[model samples]
Target: MTGSLETFLSTAEVHDAVFSLRPDYRAMLVVADGFDAGPSDAASEDALQAGEAAARAALRDRPVTEVPHVAAWREAYRAFGAKPQRTRNSLEAMMRRAEAGLPRINRLTDLYNAVSVLHQVPVGGEDLDRYRGAPRLVRATGEEPFDTVADGAAVVEHPEVGEVVWCDEAGVTCRRWNWRQATRTQLSEATTSALFILDALGPMSDEALDAATDDLTDRLTRLGPDVSVSSRLLAQ
Candidate 1:
């Protein structure tokens, strides 16, 4: 696997640790890209509804609890074009809720939601074209710095130093303040090809991560014949 794949795989270890510490907690990772339509369009209402149904069925009798963070995520998106105060407040509120353990909900949100409900853990997805290369999954190291995207929206910077980050060649991509965008790259309807990373944190069983990765790969591959999918475990 390449260095990038390795980084994502390392998240499985983190998953394991988290499970060991909090056995009642579960986590999942889901990634999809290269659909006939981009994530924005490919993740249609029908798709999300179907995904949510699948997720509900999966968690029907599980001991798992959900921390839905997608709703807050969507709210952030809705606030994206609003005034600065409203935007910042909305995003910050969503961040706090996510930190407090809320499962996010979105059209594209259902994909991760299904996995999270089934696995009984947290799951997140971001548009790769919207991320900087080599994004890090770490916390803010210093004062929050940010850059504007081609859309003219600002991303909050607060990567915790020494913590794992989904960092790109440019800087942090999707984690914390910037849950789903990078200043350098942004997903658009015009996006035809892309990369995706499914990151997990804490001590998780290899079998589990593999299963998740396999399932994700299978579904995404069917989305397009030219779609390229790869997986790896990142070493801390």
Candidate 2:
């Protein structure tokens, strides 16, 4: 599937408006194929457990808002007119749930979610095969359709005008930045090839983001033999 890999290399675009909104923003796009994919196994379970421990250590006795990276995401959310409290970023939401427990979605999703919490970054994984075009980050015009599940049924929603979102030619893949992912492209047990997005802001250094990326790559490599992975760093 050289063509598939090339599609990922098409250079994901970050709209000028999005960059202007937060000059410190950066994203790491990771694509992996030929790896074993299925429901959460022992390896993923252990990773989730370790990630939970790391999150607890980071939180210690502090509130989620006090975490530096989380605070940065909160500020980013506010910059786009989103209420951080009412609609939390993925990173903040994961950390808050760490005390209770993170969900065991699937091997790919679980591992990425663990890496997200372990390194204090917001990581989103999607079925690469489901994507129709190169991913792009932009300020939504409130017209893009976002397919999602609500109340145990399928539904379509739109983002508020001027909100930050990740989308493809199909529609919005993620809404309100990293707050939520669309069901249309979400990872599942049947997925063998996947795309992972690691979101970061000013508070997280390049080194920190790389560490998280490395951690994820390493874990994915160990899942099975012949796992091929590629990554690209998107920044201003």
Candidate 3:
């Protein structure tokens, strides 16, 4: 995946412009596989809290503004519940846009989420090593069967075919198409190295993509020196 940084930012700019015009607009960029969920550090927790706070603030004065992507995602998960055959929804549709055709967002997941907030777009990262094999962004084929762990204790079996998914060299790394991640490949506090990704879909401008990429790279560097980040436009 090779492209100028400017190309990425331009994509982001287009999304930003659209968001600016919406009455209630919110977006989220998330790092999926980087941090260990065992126990979030105060700082990491703080960052998550800050994001929640920002979302709340955005909705404080509005009756029907755009809702934060994360909040919407949570709702989608609840609506799906624990059915035998889970399927993809609107939120997952947006997430797949980021996972497809992007260079690995290194270090479990640092760069992806950093830019997610910057661009107001929901983004995600997953660890390829933990999976059975190399991961691919594709719609789930009913023929492929998989299991995912949620909240550490509950195991969910989803038997939907043609749902968007990240297929690792081994098997399905994440099940919710893109809405929720599997526990096996999740990043941990012990992870010091990783592949990061940032995603945006729809009609986006070059400038926004550039800015988001630059901003994410800069932030990742400050967090740790061993991180490397890159980008790719999803192939249609």
lDDT of 3 by residue, 117-179 (tens): 435555555543454533455555655545565577656465455444555545665554355
Highest TM-score among the candidates is held by which one?
2
For candidate 2, what is the TM-score?
0.97
TM-score rank, highest first?
2, 3, 1
Worst window of 10 by summed lDDT in candidate 3 = 25-34
Better of 1 and 3 by lDDT: 3
CA lDDT of 155 in candidate 3?
A: 65
Report RMSD for candidate 2. Answer: 1.1
Candidate 1 backbone clash number: 54
Choose 2 or 3, whichever is better by TM-score.
2
Q: lDDT per residue, candidate 1, 1-236, as tens digits?
A: 22443344344323233233323323333334446533433444444445445454544564112223333333333332323233332223332333234333433444444444334333445555555444344333544344545356654655444322345545655433334444444444454434444434333455666676675566566666766555554433
Model 1 stretches astray by more than 4 angstroms: 1-35, 39-47, 54-123, 126-132, 147-164, 177-186, 201-204
Off by over 4 Å in 3: 1-46, 61-118, 150-156, 203-206
